[model samples]
Target: MKIAESHPRRRVAVLSTVIAAIMLYLFIQDVFGAVKKQEETEIITERSAWLADWRWEAGTNDLEVVAGGLTSLQVFAAYFDESDSLLLTDKFREAMPRIKQLAEQNELNDLYLTVVNDIKYPNDTDSQKNTSLVTRLVADWESRSRHIDEIIAALETFGFTGAELDYEKIAEEDWPKFAQFIHELDYRLQKKGKSLRVVLEPRAPIERIKLPKGPAYVMMAYNLYGGHSGPGPKADAAFIRKHATRMKKVPGNSYIALSSGGFDWHSGTGKAVGITEKQASELATRSESTPERDKASGSLHFEYNDSDNVKHTVWYADGTTLSQWIDAAKAKGIQNIAIWRLDELGSESLEQLRIQPGYKIE
Candidate 1:
């Protein structure tokens, strides 16, 4: 009888022990699972800046103010001459010394030269983006080789760490050849211990295009609304997320270029001109109009009358807008960002770039 009673107590002890083990396992799992989820959600980012040739003074000044935060700097300085040879703009020539000084002081060795497709005629006539020139230049081997040589030579002469091709308005037929040229350039540049960056317009068929694997591809994400369109935010959350998704097809390290300004549209003439954040803010203050932030885009929009009593609509990205843009890009798994033509930026926006923020991936 005593032995049977002991058996029941022993069985009860075993069951209780099993239950305690399971409870301890559940407790440890819950604690560790929370940590793993937090680790997975944390996102970090990097930032770079473009110093425009046309606005080199302001760009240089702004860059100096934010140099400590930048990982690299691209001088938007090179263009095509009348003969399609590489030509450095006058402003770029003048700003080189100061730029070099800043780079050395800031330890920014990843200096790049950005060459655009624009051709400046000698007569000071209307300089334009010559898609025809691009077609002929890249489609023909002789021309393409010569152009690549010129770019490489310039990079060597100027000690640029890399070269950025900002060819815009490329005809659809020329894309294959353009892509071929990029591959060829990347090969040659790599041989010479240099790097290459290829900038794609918003309309580029990234999904179907077979771009070279070596070069860093930059997708121009801004310009959803610009001089070409009516007044609106330069970029919205949807626009950025769409391009960020589209950029998945682009090989290698890629960047989404965000702009930091807005446009003022005149109602009478239906003409819109670009304006900086400061300019937009000043206009709003002058007209005593409150700029309302667009919830969808995180951009500020307002209406004001000019001195001539012409009604105008302005849409611009401020510091808050930039932060929101960064978050939108992060949600799409893009961590590298480039600011287009960093000139006359407000302090808060500069801070956003400097910190290269770390946020939740979602």
Candidate 2:
């Protein structure tokens, strides 16, 4: 209270203490910001690794199949969701041999159930129309609500390991029914010494969709047709990683960025369909009306070259974009990569897919 005759040095010391405190606060804030940025986007997540074994899409080796083959993911989609009658009765008798052979392949890990949403819906039965390959399910929900059982029986019968629900083009109205199907199916699979592992391949928000409590959810915002809409894989990986880290749980075994690289032209309009000029031109002139998305002209022929050349082609198709994909994946700590529809791919195109980082051909 003596108006404390403070020395100038003492005043300077007090000011220095305040300044240090401010610097420390600023340093903490900067650190928090950097961590937030890294966790918020796929660019900083973690890249893929060799720690886990790989999976590859299989069953058929057409162009679609081939393009999907480059990654470790196996068997594009199991082509399930056929007629409810056929699914229930095992009407795919003729296909048993192939399925059996596929099952026998030791490298096999997962089988995708492509039309997941269509597995429990109704469709027109007009023979005149050959548009939808999807024969939406119309079987007993109680008996067939267990779609997992439907698939597990086959997977178990064939000795396969995994199944994917590739419900790509589902309408919002169908989500409830789809959710019910998953719940019931997973319950059934768990009973028969078979536990169900689901990949929530929904195109909508994970919140909007109902999923089994334990199924692995592959969080994605995809436009099956609109390839490069959002920041794409870059942003997607980050978004998914953030939730995964915060939730302290990882859905979907690996972080996969969906992509296709077979035909650069859509059959109808301007879409990429992994085709060559010849195939596109043929469909264009055919009395067999062409679908309008897009088409490729002067496409390279997929004749057999060595695995080296095929590998080169597989690695380069969408060269620029894939670079972004791989880079994003590495950033997101994503280890497993699954491509859809490997069976639709062509041979040479498939041969080019890289099973590993370097050369991989037997």
Candidate 3:
């Protein structure tokens, strides 16, 4: 009887030992898994901290991802009708919710409403059509003042934090009127606790257009090459440096707008078409071409043959090129960097900016 009882007790002890071993294994696995997850979280936090010193501005358009992971966003062109009244398109209204969502996710300050007078949409139509209308509007002080008042009312109604005046193609003669209009609008917007931003051409007569205090002036430093122009770097390093120097002379806050997209120029007709980075890469791959970077311009270019057997040359900026531009801008004392359209930025391009040294995302 004693031998049989001892055997049963020994079997119970073996079973208890197996259970303890399994429990220990699970505990170790859980601890390692948690450590790995924490490391990943830390890496993500560090990545997001990049670009903290500079303001990143993107324009909102048909692309859903335009505002993704950006610091600030501007709604594409709320146009002005022939009556000098502000027109908010249905498309812009529809895009606001998504833009706001992205802003919240990225911890952005506020969404900016861009005001323009360009008539055509879906494509950047010629501003020539609206030039006459703008001239008429600015010529009449009373009419312009009333129009500005209406714009202020619309801003309050739409819940926009600020407004970006993107009125393009003004005749050089109308520079003073345009400047006065901005001054008045800036004054009124400030009273309501709002801000104003002006988008000026790289060659814009900065001396002529005097902005009111507290308004940011964004220099359009892109379009050095595009669909309309011959295939070349969108903006060369030398050109950017020259304009950056001019931007420094401006009195208040200023920003440099850079191009991150490329244009596919048809070798036959010289007709260039806008293409995203992904599209450009896919085309290059299909044509068995490798993109080459121009060290002098800091741009990437490639030649590809299409289904029609037509040879085309593509010129655009990528992550590496943009990184070089940012370095140059920082060295030149540029405080803010704005990409023309955010949707053009690829994952790789964004990653390049993330790993750049000496910047933090706040």
Top candidate by lDDT:
1
**What is each predicted model's overall lDDT from 0 to 1?**
0.87, 0.39, 0.69
- TM agreement with the true structure for every prediction: 0.87, 0.47, 0.76
Name the best candidate (by TM-score): 1
Itemize residue pairs with steric clashes in candidate 1.
none
Q: Write the per-residue lDDT of candidate 2 for residues 72-144, one digit (tens) a residue.
A: 3333334433354323223333444554354345333343332233332235232321123322432347545
lDDT of 3 at 85: 69
Model 1 lDDT, residue 249, Cα: 91
lDDT digits (tens) for residues 1-362 of candidate 3: 99988998999999999999999999999999988776644321111111110112223332234334444556654776545567676666665665666667656656677777665444544343376767876786897788788778777887777888777777788888887888888888889999888888876887656655678888877788886589998888777787888887677877777877789999899999987776777777855657889987788898888889998999888888877876676557674776665554676676653342233432
* Model 1 per-residue lDDT tens digits across residues 1-362: 99988998999999999999999999999999988987887755567889988888888888788888787899888888888788887788888999999889988888999988888888876366689879878977898899999999999888899999888989999999999999999999999999999888899988888998999888898999988888889999999999999999999988889999899999999889988877887888855667999998999999988888889999999899998997898789788899986888888888887774346464
Candidate 3 colliding pairs, count: 3
